[model samples]
Target: MIHFPEIQSEIQFLTKINEVELHILREDQIYPSISGNKFRKLKYNLEEFSKGNYDAILTFGGAYSNHISATAAAGKEFNTPTIGIIRGEELSEKIAENPTLSFAQKAGMKLKFISREQYRNKSNPEFLEKLKSEFGNIYILPEGGTNELAIKGCEEILNENTREFNYIACAVGTAGTISGIVKSSENQQIILGFPALKDSGFLSDEINRFTNRSNFKLIKDYHFGGYAKVNNELLEFINDFKRQFGVTLDAVYTGKMMFGIFQLIQNGFFPKGTKILAVHTGGIQGNEGMNRKLKHANKTTII
Candidate 1:
């Protein structure tokens, strides 16, 4: 079995003038690379991989995907080769400029860049056959590493300490983490999800496929344009947040969730006496790549 230390999250109360108490579950402190929800999602997956005879593992992701980076780091730790089927073929020659891809490569993940159309066919039988022929027998992980096993791992995120909160909130990515949390949450506790992508209403159905719990709300107003897209207001919040709390949030996932949580508080979405627990799903490593893009666009960079 792959060993993972039990992480005890520290709860820091939000400094606000309301009667409601807001606290952050520091999931980012779980591990350096496999920190936050990634650690939970990958725990069982890596253990399963360790028992398999597959020589390599293949997974899908975009330029700064946390799943891709975590898989590469896991492969390196377990002495298994990894193959990353990257989203954009144009990123092939720009590896040097892409921090995420470069990190994967240095961690020994052999990258295979494909067109957006091809990437969409990642799970197609023909695509799997073609990849198997080229890379030999391999264990495949879905995009974002979200699966039944992954959700099972995420179910352990909350414990006795979190049961008292009126609402538990997190950023929804592939919906696995939220699914796990909803499944484990008490019937009286509300699970709120803040999607970092626009038009993510589809996540409701996707999350339902994992568990039948209805004690949840998908708050969709927080996405800053779309996935991986950010503006100055969001950038300023991220920077100011770090300075205030000393916790660096990734612009893509956790930052958006935090932004939404604060906005919701200010907008009176929650009752005055409501006690909220906001999860900090770590993806801070992607900040480097995001900063590169920001610099290229002449936009304010995220810290």
Candidate 2:
């Protein structure tokens, strides 16, 4: 088995609102490159890869995908070759301008840029066969790296220390992280998922596929537009949050979840004396790319 660094996530108290206590589980500090849920999601997958005869690990992701960055970093750290099927063909020439893709390239990941239409068929068997023919002996990981092994890895995020909380909250992307949390959560602890995408009603079904538990709820109001979309309000909140708590949240996921959690607190969504533990599933590296976009658009950037 491949050895992994010990997880050092800590539950830190944030503040109390309306007699409700809010705490943050700092999974973001797990590892620099492979941070937060990405680290958990990739832990067992990399172990499985270590035991396999595959020549390279091939995965799919967008230009600013934290998965792509983390996978590239993991491949480099483990001395294994990696291939990244990037979503936009236009990004081929713009790699120098994009921080995430540039980091991936520097980490020794061979990037293959494809059109948006082609990217949509990334899971298609025919398309996968074409990739296999091109890159021999590749072990394929899904777009967000949310396979069964990934879920199993995520299950380790929650422990006895987390049991005291009345509610567990996390930023949901592929639903794999929340599913694992729900599986390991105490019976009375309600797991709240804040999706980073708009119209994420389908995430319920995705979470259900992994666990039969109905104690989880997807709070759909926090997406703040959709995946990778951010507004000035969200950016200000992220900046203010960092200034106040010294915790940096990525605009795409954690920032929105934290924003929603604060809103929910003010709205009396949680009963009095409720203890909420919000999991900080990290993707802070993407903030640089997001800030670049904000700079170009003349909008507020995350601090």
Scored by lDDT, the top model is: 2
Report each candidate's C-alpha RMSD, comma-separated, in the order given.
1.3, 0.9
Superposing every Cα of model 1 onto the true structure, what RMSD results? 1.3
Q: Write the per-residue lDDT of candidate 2 for residues 28-142, one digit (tens) a residue.
A: 9888778999899899899998898999999999999999999999998889899999999999999999999999999999999999999999899999999999999899999
- What TM-score fits each model? 0.96, 0.98
Q: Residue-wise lDDT of candidate 1 within 204-263, one digit each (tens)?
A: 998999999899999998889989878899999999998998889989998898898888
Candidate 2 error regions (>4 Å): none
**lDDT comparing candidate 2 with the true structure:** 0.93
Where's the lowest-lDDT run of ten residues in candidate 1?
Answer: 12-21
10 residues in a row with least lDDT, candidate 2: 1-10
Q: Which residue pairs in candidate 1 collide?
A: none
